[model samples]
Target chain A: MGKKVLIIDDSSTMRKIVTRSLRQAGLDFDTILEAGDGQEALQLLAKESVDIILSDINMPNMDGIEFLRQKSANAAIKSIPVVMITTEAGADILAEAKSLGAKGSIKKPFTPEQVSEVLGGLM
Target chain B: MSWETHIADATVEIFSTMLMMEVSSQPPLTERIKSHQDSVTGMVGMAGLYKGMLAIHAPSQVAMTITGNFLGLEVDSVNDDVKDAMGELANMLAGSIKAKLSDNSKDIQLSIPSAVCGDSYSLDYQPQQGSSMVPFESAGGRFLVELQLEQQT
Candidate 1:
């Protein structure tokens, strides 16, 4: 068993690419669950435990920041490492995400190697 | 230098590297407006030092093909993976173009990539009338690259 990974994003395409990148990088996972937004992710997290999370910033129901805030409030969820894969690279936003307990960050248009390097170190 | 020529250079490099296609010519606007364009397009905007977007407009089939190749998968339909790949391509290309333009303009900030998909769409910059439109045909399908901008004169 590699690890249980949770992917949060509004776009299914993005989730798939991240998933594909993980597989391509040979990161094995026993389970992979996806949510359309932060609230959905929270619901999933309430029931199951995951080792890592790969999330996007912009979303409808709830965004990555909200997700991180909520995660931080919950002791059990807060402990799991989070890797934010979003297009927002603004320094303020990056600093906020860092403060919210994100394990690391990767910008858009990332390659498998890039994804590997970010999460590989954390996980 | 004209916006048309600059767009051509950017398109050439993006088409070759990202799409793995070659641009034999920088087709005219009339020819571009006339192509059987894809209905859905993924568009991204920029501002500051460098501006404009890298739009990937493709028909349903073509979009799927490009997305599939990008993810190194065999996709038969439009999925989250496909859209993400298209959006990310726009980001990558825009980033690359920003890098290339660094030789001329070094201090530009890039906005996060945004996307829009529909039957038909158009992307343009303000300071109207001057724009560069580059059309390309790849194994996946035909697409266009436009570099619309306003240089402080």
Candidate 2:
């Protein structure tokens, strides 16, 4: 079975773009789910089984760092790998995300090659 | 590269690679008027080692074109897609620049992006440290990206 990927971002346009890029990067995934924010993503995680997550840092209800913190503490979903895709280019933000157990990160305006490289061996 | 070069590179990269539009940026301007009667403004705030704002302003028609290209749809008006796309563009630009500025230290925090659209409006920004505006032309339409930075007090 192919991997099940989940994408979380506030912008629907971004979600579409990331989805397209994932496919272009040659990651075979049977299911690709999406959420508008961390809260919505948690809701989806409770009801579904996702293998990997691609998330955005800044969001309305709950941000990616908080989501990572919550997910890290939950045994039911703690093992899933999260890759942050965001425009928050600060080193502090990146360190926080890493401390919260983010497996990797890809900055905004990324290319397919970069996505593929980051997802290497993770998927 | 300088901050202005970074902004120009990010703008060109985003539009060319993601939106598949060719962007031509003019020389950076130290002083310029940004607001327009019918324009879309996307803004993102930064706080930490540096505090200021980054914004992208484009005429409504230009914004619609960019949004349409981003979403692969035919956009004709200022809708949610236009606002969201512009905000995301600003977010991306801010992040890219922040990364360049924060290479050695972890001292930047980015705020969530916000967008506004109007038929007529004015923006009054008094930068305490530094600021620049760069105009870009793409697909026959023009837009401007502005960056302002100041040391946090």
Candidate 3:
């Protein structure tokens, strides 16, 4: 089966960087998707399916926490895995994300090896 | 141990690890620079236990160069990519400083990143408790990371 990944981030630069990092990490997917925020990601997920999600914790409009909340409520997309890519290293928020179903998190200014080490097991 | 060192270390780490560029930090600025010419500024605010702002100011050429390095492309103008790249850099720097400020992540809250750039501009802020600006030299050029903070009583 072909794998698809959706990246949610307000910064277009960061999205591009993640796409490049996934490539650098050698985590190749059949299709790569993007969204500006959780709202956009949810909307996209409603019509399409992705194997996994990589989202930023801080974003305008809808944030990753709310996205996780809403996704967990929806049975259709609740099972898909999510990983946070953020600069927020606060244990409280990351713990919240874990409780909400975030598989893992990668901080900003992360290296390719770090990304791979986290996502390798999940992928 | 100072805010200057924190800002300097964060900036250098971001550039070296994320942007794949080696940057060197210079001595702390003795005076604040309010005006900028052909430059871009990326800023994020912190509220709650700590209240202040983190800003990164870079010349237009240097900003474009940094943006290029960020996205692995050649950038020639101060476009949206440059602004977003700069804002993300500010976000990362603020996050690092926030970690040093307190163990509880919820103690401080960071605002969404913002960017401002043009031919000429000036940013004015009234410092309450502590303020520091650190300069750095990258392959592109020199840039400064400025932080203003006041701990709530």
Candidate 4:
């Protein structure tokens, strides 16, 4: 079976774009699930098993950093690598996310090749 | 590159790469308003190091075209899809410009994007000491990107 992936972003349009980009990048995934924010993603994780996560940093509730903090503390879901796709241009934020155990990050206006390159090793 | 150049470049790249539309910068307009009667505006605010607002404004028709191209579907009018697409564009543009600003952008915090649509409306960045409005033309339509920064205390 192909790996399962979870995509989290508040914007449905962005979620669709990320999904399409992932497919275009030729990532083999059997199923792709989506959530609007980190809080919702946590709820989804409670029931589903996903190999990797693609998330956005700025969201209405439970931003990516806090979500990562919570995820890191949980033994069950801590190992699932998360790749942040966000428009946050702060190097400090990026460093903070990396310190929190994010596998990688792809900035906005990114290409499919960039997405594939970032997630290839992790996934 | 200067902030104006960055905004122009990012706008073109986003439209070209994401929406598959070709866009070129137009001369700066004295009046910030560049949209037609019916238009949509996407706005995002930045805080911390560089406090300001970034906005994208497009006529309803242009918005529909962008929405359609982004979603890979034919959109006949302005709807949730168009608003969402515009908001996403604003977010991406702010982020792209933030990156180009180098270390000065390290502490900047971006607000969630907000959008508005109407036949006639006005936005004032009052109390803002510095601002830049850049216009671009795609095909036959014109849209704008404006950056307003708060005056340093």
Residues A1-123, model 3: lDDT tens digits: 789999999999999999999999999898999999999999999999999999999999999999999999999999999999999888889999999999999998899999899999898
In candidate 2, position B57 carries an lDDT of 95
- Candidate 2 local lDDT, B46-117, one digit each (tens): 888898889999999999999988878899889998999999889888887787777733577778888999
lDDT value, candidate 4, whole model: 0.86
Ranking by DockQ: 3, 4, 2, 1
- Give the fraction of true interface contacts kept by model 2: 0.67
DockQ of 3: 0.89
In Å, residue B70's CA in model 2 sits off its true spot by 1.7
Against the true structure, what is each candidate's TM-score?
0.70, 0.91, 0.98, 0.94
TM-score of 1: 0.70
* CAPRI level of candidate 1: incorrect
Measure candidate 2: CA RMSD: 2.0
DockQ result, candidate 1: 0.15
Q: Total backbone clashes of model 4?
A: 0
User: For residues B1-153, what per-residue lDDT tens digits would candidate 3 score against the true structure?
Assistant: 778888888888999998999999999898889899999999999999989999999999999999998999999889999999999999999999999999888899999999999999999999666899899998899999999999999
Estimate the lDDT of model 1. Answer: 0.69
Query: Which one wins by TM-score: 2 or 4?
Result: 4
Q: Report the C-alpha displacement of residue B4, candidate 2, in angstroms.
A: 2.5
DockQ of each: 0.15, 0.60, 0.89, 0.70
- The Cα RMSD in angstroms, rounded to one decimal, for candidate 3 relative to the true structure is 0.8
Off by over 4 Å in 2: A90-92, B104-106
